[model samples]
Target: MTEHLTIVDHPLVQHKLTHMREKTTSTAGFRRLLREISNLLAYEVTRELPVTTREIETPMNTMQAPVLDGKKLVLVSILRAGNGLLDGVLELIPSARVGFVGLYRDEETLQPVQYYFKVPQELEDRLVIAVDPMLATGNSSVAAIDLLKKAGATNIRFMCLLAAPEGVARMKEAHPDVPIVTASLDERLNEDGYIVPGLGDAGDRMFGTK
Candidate 1:
């Protein structure tokens, strides 16, 4: 995931995202779809993870089997909506450590304000993947990464369900070294800083909040 941005356009990912975007979709349905899509996105995000082989004995033979190398990766959810994706990725990588970064947008300023932050130790020794449902303004994402870096994380990647061009540019400019992986790169953001043609406020829809 060295590229600045990676869009996963797999047919299944696109199909599930469509259903999630539908206004008529129920809360449970939206959540289920998000979890499924998260799995697909995780596959693309971890595509370049390091691997090593170890000799093992099979039923009737001995061979070297490839397995993930180094320390267990860290999954840092961006709080609230990020939990939706976190649940799915956890199922895929149960051994990975989990953490959270709590941030909210200041409507007037359209900036991010952090409220809470907690992550695993030895971040510099393991890969760090930050998960968030939407990358609308990118303020929160960039701010979160800033905190992660200050805490000793050298390798970090960002994962989101939907991203706006504005947010993508904001991230690239703020943190050129961190790569972004998303399901769709949607149209520009709206006046309120919402991703146009996006699946709406991910936190609201997933939680059935107004």
Candidate 2:
């Protein structure tokens, strides 16, 4: 887990995250906060992106400055709740290509079944970031990554709003190469599989559902 986990501790991220955690936050408020926090998280996540020096002229001088190198980034949202994070990340990188993975758990078997998935044309050539609000059992997260890998994504990173210890360990064991950026690593999941002290189901809160 040492190599896989990178917890963001920026004050703005933490402050917005705190508002996202409050139970009284309305659907509109939750959506807005998630978007704001996601932008902050996206900033940290893309901080180390490869940059190439290019000549640029300022009002007073011409100098070489860094610019993003290689192909445009690809953002793969892990459905419903992932869209919430996606919205904010897009605000920062509006030109990034977008993809979607739709997975739903079968209550009886407790397994993830993919219903939809679409990725960019050349996945292997681009940096891919998979977004999801909660890393719960890690089943769906792992499954989503499997799909992306099958589609030729070699460089991948996982971004989430909140995560649990079990899920973090599971993701590390399943996909050690994919680093995870999260707001907070909370206590263990409750019996019902929700992260203890978590804000609640991100999809429900974001959409005024449930």
Candidate 3:
């Protein structure tokens, strides 16, 4: 439950996610809750980022102070719903560089097709975190990672609100080095590839897309 992937079970995260999954939660409420929970999830995902120290003068005296290492991190959103989570995370890591990978599933094929892709420069040098609210089938998530790799990203992490078992296995098989941090790992995906007991379509619920 906590090795290659982490299920964030903090009380705040759980409470917000519970509200988020309710069908009766309004669009504005859903969006607000998503952002709040994202901050909590981002806190856990970035916990092990490498850090360095520099000497600086404090109010009392000069001392070496800890700081995040290297250039600003790169946050790559997986489009549409990803943007909702992205906004919340940015409030926490405001200086991070941002990027987006837009993909939509082919209803017939159930495969991902990328439409837009742009990343910050020097991706390989900066830590990269990809955000998507739902990881149901994992096709789009995996494809997004593939594009990031081609763009020279090496160190990467994935964060989502909920994940299906199938999606987790797919991610583990495709990108074992990239860790996944999610609010919950739900049961199986339904016949149509939706996570069982999922919060409906994340993009629809969050944006009133319908």
- List per-prediction Cα lDDT, in the order shown: 0.95, 0.92, 0.93
TM-score of 3: 0.97
- Clashing residue pairs, backbone N/CA/C < 3 A, model 1: none
TM-score for each candidate, following the candidate numbering: 0.98, 0.96, 0.97
Kindly give the stretch of ten consecutive residues in candidate 1 with the minimal lDDT sum.
1-10
Pitting candidate 1 against candidate 2, the one with the higher lDDT is 1
Q: How do all the candidates rank in terms of TM-score, highest first?
A: 1, 3, 2
Model 2 lDDT tens row, 52-142: 9999999999999989999999999998899999999999999999999999867666578999998898999999999999998888999
Extract clashing residue pairs from model 3: none
Clashes of 3: 0
Question: Of 1 and 3, which scores higher on TM-score?
Answer: 1
Give per-candidate clash totals: 0, 0, 0
Highest TM-score, which number? Answer: 1
Any runs in candidate 2 off by more than 4 Å, and if so which?
none
